[model samples]
Target: MSQTITQETQTPTVPAAHEAPPRGGKLAGRVAFVTGGTRGIGAAISQALARQGATVASGYAGKTERAQDFLHDLQSAWAGHETEFSIHQGNIGNPEDCRRTIAEVIEKHGRLDILVNNAGITRDRVVSKMSDDDWQQVIDVNLSGAFYLSQAALKHMLERGTGRIVNVSSVIGEMGNIGQANYAASKAGLFGLTKTLAREAAFQLARDGKLDDDTIGVTVNAVTPGYVLTEMVQGVPDKVLDKIKGNIPVHRLARPSEIARVVHFLCADESGFITGQVWGVNGGQDM
Candidate 1:
């Protein structure tokens, strides 16, 4: 099946029952690896997974101190779960690093269950002013990195016969941005990747006879968050922020945890049938 690109316009009104429990232990024995998880949305996703009883190994590029701090904070927050937190420092843009990171995680944890490709970088420039380097860097990290890591993790996931892969896409990837040509292309590509992988996984499960009337396992999905309040957006001018807010029905940027919660759901077994799809967490911006 071909991938479909979705332009997000509004925040989804999740039913009250779907709200994540405050101290629920839903992911009791899962293992997850979140890329660029040292800070921002990535950090929130890592913590959410850990809180739900998943052993999380987060990847970081250059933020050693911050990575350590995140690990410490997660350890304290989930003091009762016996959750294991580890930091894997590697550049996701490098395919070798991507492979090594997953290999290391499997070595330590003995298995891999979930892969979240959340590492991304932006090199904003108008078409006229954008340099080749600017475009290449964004593509390398935002797009290629996810491909590398997903390919690496696929080996393990396909072998294991059950897994979740969530790619962190963006609202701009759907609706073009003024100065984000490269970022938009990369994120758009991620939507395609998510769909293709989902189909492949479904076929593989069917071949293995894992898809029974009562049980259908394995899922792949994407989460496209709207203007989130992270350091990455701190560079936006006040006017730009105001304009973005005006576009959103909620009239506010999303908190990192809001996006994280959606990611957590997509990674859970409950979402096994929800594959080859993109869920937009925008606050009515696209509408």
Candidate 2:
């Protein structure tokens, strides 16, 4: 006769009430900086981050009146939130101003946990007809500006041993569209910049003297939002937008909040393992 052994399942262990509080918003206690965050997709990103309990500094290159109004709207939206929002005015296209803005955010917040390079302008024109000013202007703001800001923020982040950077690219960049040569070029450059920075940041984090630290790391990613109902995309004639929508598998343009949600997700602590990715927010639009 052989005796059979019975195994009993162990009871699960739960932390006592005094152990630690449950995690709040993924970005609670974090500070985020967003460029061109006064309106449209940028504003949506700022608001979404704030909703996640992150203090946000929104940079805008425009009139004070609009900036003030945007800030007021953001405050209203976050009436009950502990998140704080501050608006900064500067032209990120200028390296000096771009760096200054990042410096100012760190000065005010005492820390910078995330950076969203969401500022961009489209100077759409056929390659043959594009003017020097148009090409250079878009490039300056969309590509060069991102580089300047990222360089400034990386300094603080590397010192702190962790950070998140999200660059806003475009669907046009992947598949060039008609009359968008300069715009496409500027957006396309973001992909390379994002990937390179992600690699550099990862390497630095690994060597940051925190070999056994699980929380010491940096992540850099890019977002390509498809046609969205923003001031930028609304410039397209309704008929043209309709045709474009028809082509989308979702049969509609993306809401700015939808794109913002993805950005916020990428900036969360849970996304630490995700880096050097081009997270597309398009409605299944190819290329």
Candidate 3:
């Protein structure tokens, strides 16, 4: 069904999940760590969290100049709010670097409340042609990087008795695409990691067979975004891109902010019971 807005009502906010309900600022005074958050979808997530009053630690793998520009834009965008932003420039795929990134965030923020594993790279190649290095690189960053960050942040969240872990998966993981064997595999690994880790955390926080509200548990979930208009999609030829859009019922690719909103919602305080699930922000494409 299609609908239109008239003067009687205004259009709803596209990224409604940026709001945290029951309080003036939904995530007021909290802390968030967003990896690969300097551009594209990750940047959107970082900004959304910051707008909701969470001090955001934005992580990026490279490009010092761009990181500075991103930080400036982020700060400028949220100047009205008392949101603090910092850039952690390092390759999260590097285990040691991942530790240092989380350490800096905790040291500055004094505590860590949310971890969004949005750091990922694509080494698209057919299975027969994909090099070992390409496969290894994607897995190392998309999978192990999340593991490393979550392991480091979980320690603090456990001590505080609450936390949120949102890993950015992909629709390709669900419906494997041509020349994306490595990418799909890496993302599928995220979904597996998400569910298993959620259950493990849940069991650790279990009391009398029920999750304790006072000390309930940390939640782990994955978001699968399809054909989002980001740098990653620029390689697709216009003809192919149009074909992809034609396949999607919505007739267009998803916006980065739309995916960010889903990630933001998963990290909200009210989304405790919504763990271990894969929310597809594909605009009716996958369904």
Best by lDDT: 1
- Candidate 2 Cα errors over 4 Å, as ranges: 1-24, 211-213, 231-237
Model 2 clashing residue pairs (backbone): none
Question: In model 2, how large is the Cα lDDT of residue 252?
Answer: 87
Q: Write the per-residue lDDT of candidate 1 for residues 48-70, one digit (tens) a residue.
A: 78768789998888847766776
Lowest summed lDDT window (length 10), candidate 2: 1-10
lDDT of 3 by residue, 1-287 (tens): 00100000011112233232222367777799998887777877887787677899888877778788778766666656677889898886799999999999999889899999988877766789989998999889888999999888877776677899999988878887778777788788999999988887787666434465554369999998877766555555777778878888999988777888788788888888888999998878778
Show where candidate 3 strays beyond 4 Å: 1-24, 207-211, 214-216, 231-237
User: What ordering of candidates by TM-score runs from best to worst?
Assistant: 1, 2, 3
Q: How many clashes in each structure? A: 4, 0, 0
Q: Report the candidate with higher TM-score, 1 versus 2.
A: 1
Which wins on TM-score, candidate 1 or candidate 3? 1
TM-score of each: 0.89, 0.88, 0.87
Model 1 segments more than 4 A misplaced? 1-22, 214-216, 231-239
Residue pairs whose backbone atoms clash in candidate 1: 9-284, 9-286, 9-287, 10-284
User: What are the RMSD figures for all models against the true structure?
Assistant: 6.4, 14.5, 7.4
